[model samples]
Target: QLTGISLSGDQKQKPADLEKELDKLQTEFDEIENQIRAGSPRYAALTGAQPLTLAETQQKVLDDGTVLLEYSLGNDTSYAFAVTQSGVSLFKLPPRSNIDKLATDFRAQLIPPKLQRRIVGIDVVAEQQRGLGLVEGPSENLTAFVASSNALYRAAVEPASNSFGDKRLLVVADGALNYIPFEALVRSTDGADYASLSYLIKSNEIVYAPSASVVAAIRQSGNKPSGKNLLAVADPIFSSDDSRVKGKAGVPAPAEARGLGLGLESAVNDVAGEPTAAGGLRLARLVGTRVEAEEIGKIAKSNGSQADLWIDLNASEDNLRSRDVTNYRIIHVATHGLLDAERPQFTGVVLSLVGNKDNDGFLRTDEIFNLRLGAPLVMLSACETGLGKEKRGEGVIGLTRAFMYAGAPTVGVSLWSVADKSTADLMADFYRRLLGPASSNSASVAMRAAQLGLISGKKYSAPFYWAPFVIVGDWR
Candidate 1:
């Protein structure tokens, strides 16, 4: 009941009443959990939500050449459990504070400070003009990123290096470590250029899960193959002033005024100024996503598969739900992604806001749970789609988990705010390999191949361009 309330974005209850009810329910739940713990030592272990035991995880979740690295951060010290089919090894790590700082520094290197700055209440037009070249270019602080990456590797992976030996990794991160993309971690700097660094991805294929139990659950659920190849949703109409909107009577929002705000209006204001007198938050149109969706559709069709595309005004919340999305083998959403750390329920993917009486543009996390997706892979090709509120044991509660619950065996999400062109390019390469003829590569393998391609390319060789995207849930 508490979870239902928390996840329901369209609840009619008043805020005060809801808060009180949630408080009461949480207290009752805690008391009941305590009683169950007291009654039997094994009762907690038997609960649906509890993590699977090491033996159970090894038997059910792991394959012959796969290993799980589950980290638990503590105040004084942190620990990692390297779980393999044959045995489990534990490694100690630095305190949570140390890891936190390193993760923050690393993210700073990837996301430009201009992009991170809050745009709310500011003159969006002026800000956009001043920051005309706000793209995430090569960082002058490359050494800083390298140092942080190496340090994180030393703290997190070095202690357990011997145990990992040529095995694919299933990372279950905790707290700040959840934000760190393990693939970006440098194994050795070794007189390497930005493009030629010895990243972890170069050697091992990696996937992520909120918990080992999640891995077991998703794998157990399996995927119901859909007859259709793809359902691509992109290029939402965020503002009525958009030139594409026929017969609308206002000046088109400037390209500079247009920015990706996900759906959190307070977090990022894409419009030129404050909300209109009628109180509507204007979001920037994602022109790149249109190209992205079209390219992917072409790829699917070229592979002799049927692809359904919802773009421009057709990309509405109503269309998304009405289309029976579960019939597609792969579901791709290329749009703005909002993350509300304080309120995970608010985190969502933004679609077309126009002509949708049933919903606002945002498709909240809880709302995603309601979707009946049967696709083996669901790719959220947007900024920061991988992030969510971190729970010590359960992992990051965000879009990845929502998609898993909705029936996707595998999900692709990004760790940081990414530039449009780079994201489109990376995603195009990914789908081409995944759906190509005679392709036996799993989702993780395909993602790795795409990232490697970017690393080898002269245009987007920086880790920032490719490392943010990761595969979660079942890799196979």
Candidate 2:
């Protein structure tokens, strides 16, 4: 869509106005996502045939700051190396063309061999022995980590890009991490347009924080030890907060919907000055965060129906498992969600704390299904709950689906990392219009009102306003 316009240095044309300037900026990112996705199919053409081969690879960060990857490139072939999606590769890969024609098998190893490691995640099922599947390293490289931490996050986002043709905010986790990459985690929130990115870091909120049960499942797969790369958030950013976002929180907060709308406009609607390209639009307005119950009440108030709103702020790893959610009319969790093509169960939500004490913890989707949710709706306001291992009977198996299967009629879930500041606004306004005194509106009507609240910028409206909340299923 980008025709590579030539700017006139002679009499430089500034944007006609503010909207024009923003449109220019928005189109730039729009083109980037489009270009990458458009280029995916061509990768297969750059293939070289190889005989039976089982490839071994390693990823390393050199002293000079260059990420070095060493891999076996049979006798005669010109191959370029690319880092895999995970920041945990201990090996290198040949040029995408050379390996495109060969079949491969990928198995993870425990205890990284080197300190400066590259590549954190990979999918083994898509192995193509004869150019059937494209190599994983033919995409984006993430150099998103603090220099102080001495950890560099390198990823080949091509696989995920190819898997789901739709544009998404792909989050790849490092096995079991002692510290979540808080810095890298925050950068992508303004996928498109979000209000005051700084405000989000300050608020530290999210639609869903993973449940302990789901986090445990992700851990059992390959995300244990607080060092391995196991979490990845790949979801979409819908720039509107539908007030009737069917979740717990009985006494909906009293706030207008302007904040979230503004957030979405800044995150998704603004273009910084680029022309709208042909085809669909894609921006990175997702908000991603990690909050535990101890920090924000995990267990709902009262074990019965009235308990969904105020979860026990004291709910920690010790209480996540024994908790039963069958009585509520709606369920809302601020947790994590993962999609593992190799292991769906390994794909789960991360709880706020890790330890057994009232320290927040992870939860699995399996447990979400087990809940006797008498509630008609649920909200897994966490990252990637809508995404899951692409399988047949399994369908979409993250927390959202788990609750749906467990008998919840409808649910509201996010497709990517959401902006915290926007999330607070989305939640507050959604509840205000849906369950608050203005309970006489339909889902769509409530959503429009939320959008209006964002654009209007009333007391509660913010740029991160409308883009974080999404309506899932039929919220009639």
* TM-score (all chains, Cα) for each model: 0.83, 0.35
Every model: Cα RMSD to truth: 6.5, 24.5
Q: What is the alpha-carbon lDDT for the whole of candidate 2?
A: 0.32
Query: Where in model 2 is the C-alpha error above 4 Å?
Result: 1-313, 317-321, 339-342, 352-360, 392-395, 442-448, 455-465
Cα RMSD for candidate 2? 24.5
Q: Candidate 2's residue-wise lDDT over 140-184, tens digit each? A: 111211111111212222222222222112121211211122212
Model 1 Cα lDDT, one tens digit per residue, 1-476? 34433212233445458557646765775675567557743223212356788799999889998999988888999999999999999999999898888887777776667655431112223121112234447576778778888888888888998998778999988878888789988888663567888889988999998877876666665564455479899988766666677685453432223422223442332222232322333455677888989999999899878898999877888777666776788889988776666556567887876656555556777677668876658999876889887755557878887787777878999887677788889999998998898777788999999999999895788887898899998876
Model 1's lDDT to the true fold?
0.73
Q: Estimate the TM-score for candidate 1.
A: 0.83
Report the number of the highest-TM-score candidate: 1
